[model samples]
Target: METTFVGRHVEIAQVARLMRESRLVTLTGLGGVGKSRLAHRVVEESVAEFPDGLWLVELACLTDPHLLPETVADVMGLADQPARRRAEVLAEWLGPRRSLLVLDTCEHLVEAVASLVDTLLRAAPRLRVLVTGRQPLGAPGEHVYSVPPLPVEDAVALLRERAGLAAPPDGSGGEGGAAELAELCQGLDRIPLAIELAAVQLRTLPPTVLLRRLNDRYHLLTGDGGPVRHGSLRAAMGWSHELCTPAERLLWARLSVFASGFDLEAAEYVCAGGPLPAGQVLEALTGLADKSLLQREEHPTGVRLRMLDTVREFGAEWLSRLGEDSAVRGRHRDHYLRLARRCATEWPGRQVEWYGRIRAERRNLRKVFELCLADPQWSRAGLDLAGTLWFLWVCCGMSREGRHHLETALRADPGPGPERLRALWVCAWVAALQGDLAAARERLDQCRAEDPEGSVTGHVLQVEGMLALLRRDHARAVELLEEAMAWHMAKGGVLSGLLPCHALAALGLLAAGRPAEAVETLSEGQALCEVHGEEWSRAQMEYVFAWAGHVEGEASGALRHARSALASALGFEDLSLSAACVEMIAWAVTEEGDAGGGAWLLGVAQAVRDSLGLPRSGSGIFAPVREQTLTQAVKVLGGAGFDTLFAEGQGSDLGIAVKYALGEKIS
Candidate 1:
């Protein structure tokens, strides 16, 4: 939206009209035809009718078909719950909304995208899907629009507009330069990316000289692969590649290792080395950005650099040609591995910042995980990475994805080692959370049998206690959790392990009706969290405090603590904790006699839970209290009145609901 958009009025109007008539529309064209850009502009213009939200999913970075749902969910700002099919959860949440879902560059995953789009469309009747790809997905009742190349005149305008940044165009050639410019656009097949790539050359090349160079460029890259229509892009890309310095060319090739765009630090670490020194990477990157080979996106933290898919593909081919693909990939794997360790180590504080960084690196992380699992040498690294990110899987909303990665790593690299043992423990914990108790126990037993030194005994005890708590064996859960805490203490304080231990122990106390003990138990966790500046784990303890306070009829205390917990929970993107906090908030609100507000919050909580596929397997223990809260709200606001308020909350977007829950004034 920030860039100056050239003319596409006819295509834009056609796409918008198609969207009005069809729930699913696919824009098909050659690689550089600007389908994605057109889709963005069309959606921006047509967003008023879709009140729920507008989500754009970029599929170019996703190679594995299985990750499609998770990728889409990530774009939707959701961390999927474990056990429930991600698609089912997505549909359940979207079933009542009017949202626009845009899938860009899905040509590589047509079948998978088609299936998912079909499911969401069927379930969310009000949902509309607009897709841009090289070809149509062929979904039933799909409207396919073949996006033509930009008109030669519009392409000339774009080239002129783009070239204007450096200097005004020369109006000296053949009838106000129209002939020369149109020839350039036609030579480039009127493809926007190719034209833009050539337009930047105008800063150095005169229009006549550029048109002459295009002839040589076309013959230069003759017989190259791809549709004939894509020749302009390939030639334009080849010409640009030829023009770049050696450092820039090598940097471009090496930077292809990143699954998505990356920050400067990443480029320096991963793309620098060999001919291109680390010190020179920034300059080369700047050159590439200047040439329009890389796109610079400014974020709150810094500027991110990304290559268009077509350009990246060209670089990838060159990376292979230079026989540096494997080596670059290894470097990439190591860089992200170090990043993972840093994130784990620094997670004591800055939990919110950690979440942001992790969310930003999600696609790259997935790429690294896949690479690790696919290669034996990196199997241990994969297992280690998955195990180390337990906070992401357990505390954040990624239990399902965590479980998948852990399971894959476990199967890929089977052995008796620290990484395997930890992966086993983490996998069991995720399993227990997902309600697969049998698998959870099996993995826990494997940990004990394989871990001869029993280093993870504390972890084993904690998860076993969690299973017991899930089974409603409160006394047994309390005993085992205390034992786990004792084990952690004897082991010289597994601080990371101790935090969750304390929270679970407090929950066991509260579940067993010992609210006083729960409060006392949580105070220690609060102190521990404060000592370390731990927000995520501390948020969990706060939720337990809210729970204990509510159980003891301290509605005001519950409300206060719930508010604190929900804020941090949201910061860390922990929807499970958010749901728990919101439920506690609703309970306190209803008890304080704002039954209407409580009823609305209750609806918000349920909708969030359903979106997460909550109240499943491991989390059904709170059903009783939830039912009681619902009944109380219904009594205060009669059944019909309650449904109206509840539906209102359910129908609201996650952001609006979160704002209202956080005390923002909303109708």
Candidate 2:
């Protein structure tokens, strides 16, 4: 690591102070504006403060986001690193080390990098993060310093020095153009990578001519030096792309489907479509990363991978050239469609896997939903995705996203035949989950009004019952549940799946105050889930059991089952289940005479609720659970306490649940 830096003197001092004041210091700037160089200097200069040697995790060569934490662990020489999770290992390793960790070029892998940074900051008191990227990581307590490009005079001087060229002649001739060229460099976003690229054209082309060419031929004007080492920003991406093998190229082309971020499993599942094998995606991804085409980073629970804007642009061009955009996107839609259908079929059972898969595919899947709604031919695909993700919105805790897409698709084609009716029911379910009983009623009324004798009437009724329970309409909820239950029996057990059963249990157990019967109903649901191989559904059953036990004075039993539910929720990345279980734990803590513990749990639930952007309907699971937990907690502690839990959970757009019970807003 070199302690010497050419520019960014102010940036260095500011960043150093931020690091001293905060554990996490993020350095964001346009690419190649000496971010990496500046970071290297800071670590080298600050290296003596850290008794433990500085650890550098160069994201430039890491393609598989899942491998990021493990890569860091390897650099730190830690053994027995788990393949499935590396962040945990990293946090444990850094827990005691007083060291500087430089995370370079993390813009592409923003989500994963944010997660890892968060965990390390939480677990390691003495460890400091020096991150460089195109944007601030948006982590808590992160002091961000945006590094600008070199000044014009400095830029000209640096260009002359690097290109080994003479200063332009005074005035007249092309001299004025030289000054104009320097100005043009600043307009190119003051990005050092862009400036260095512009300097390369000086050797072969006059300044004015080169500037004129830059507008139309960004690729040509971007290069300097020899053809082999073009050294232009565009050339850098091109160079990286060219080094990829055919399989890697194919994967890279397909990866353009993602508008935001994605994970390895998603890449393998969607990008592989006969071009690359699942077994080799990790390796091909590695190849792309080695070429600087893809970047990998670690999230708290998983990995998120991304491509630079310039690199992604190159990939988009390549994808267009291949004429495979539509084909690949269709494949992307189909894969997620199949997944949505499968997960919907298995919902409320294997809650952990459900949330995990949703969390992994949420970003790309949202794009797929857009494509489906945009094209009539793909509208059913959109409906399928929206319909299947309904559980994700309601039970799994993704109602905000679910409602957004569902409403979009429904508006695109609002007709209530059977499929449309199902969509309506799903839409209603989302509204109900959000505690917007009014909205749920409105959608339901529209469904009934449009199709009085539709085939999906039974499904509509089932949702009606579920919403009734959600709104504490125990009597109406029970009647609706029974009616839908009889209809399911009449139809040979069709729509009487998890939601209906869960609705019945919720009504019978909570609203009706029959904890024993609710326990029995939940037990039956669990057995059915196991028989049907619905792990996510079974987790929901466990959550019900926990809820019932909490109400029945069996705090120990409730805690044990809630833990199981949470484990399953994590496995599935089911936000709803995680939130539900957290709420349940809070309730149990209150029941167990641990008001302080209960408040903490409520705080976490609030954070989860806010992060998922769960609507504040004052009736949804979170609100009801939060209210009940707080009410009981007040009883246990003689008051709800002076702290407001909901206010503490608002950390940022990332929406990390700060605490489980209190629902404190995070600033």
**Clash counts for all predictions:** 0, 56
Over 421-500, each residue of candidate 2 has an lDDT whose tens digit, in order, gives: 77788888777665567878888888888886656666677778877676667777767776776676667543234434
In order, candidate lDDTs are 0.85, 0.65
For model 2, the stretches where C-alpha displacement exceeds 4 angstroms are 1-10, 14-231, 241-254, 260-287, 296-306, 321-325, 342-351, 489-500, 513-516, 546-667
Q: lDDT score of model 1?
A: 0.85
Q: Which lDDT tens digits does candidate 1 get at residues 587-649?
A: 888898989988888888887777677663216556655677789999988999999998887
TM-score, every prediction:
0.95, 0.62
Model 2 / residue 521 / CA error / Å = 2.4
Backbone clash pairs for candidate 1 read none
**What's the distance in Å from true for residue 326, model 1?**
1.4
Where is the poorest 10-residue window by lDDT in model 1? Answer: 166-175
Measured over all alpha carbons after superposition, the RMSD of each candidate to the real structure, in angstroms, is 2.3, 12.3
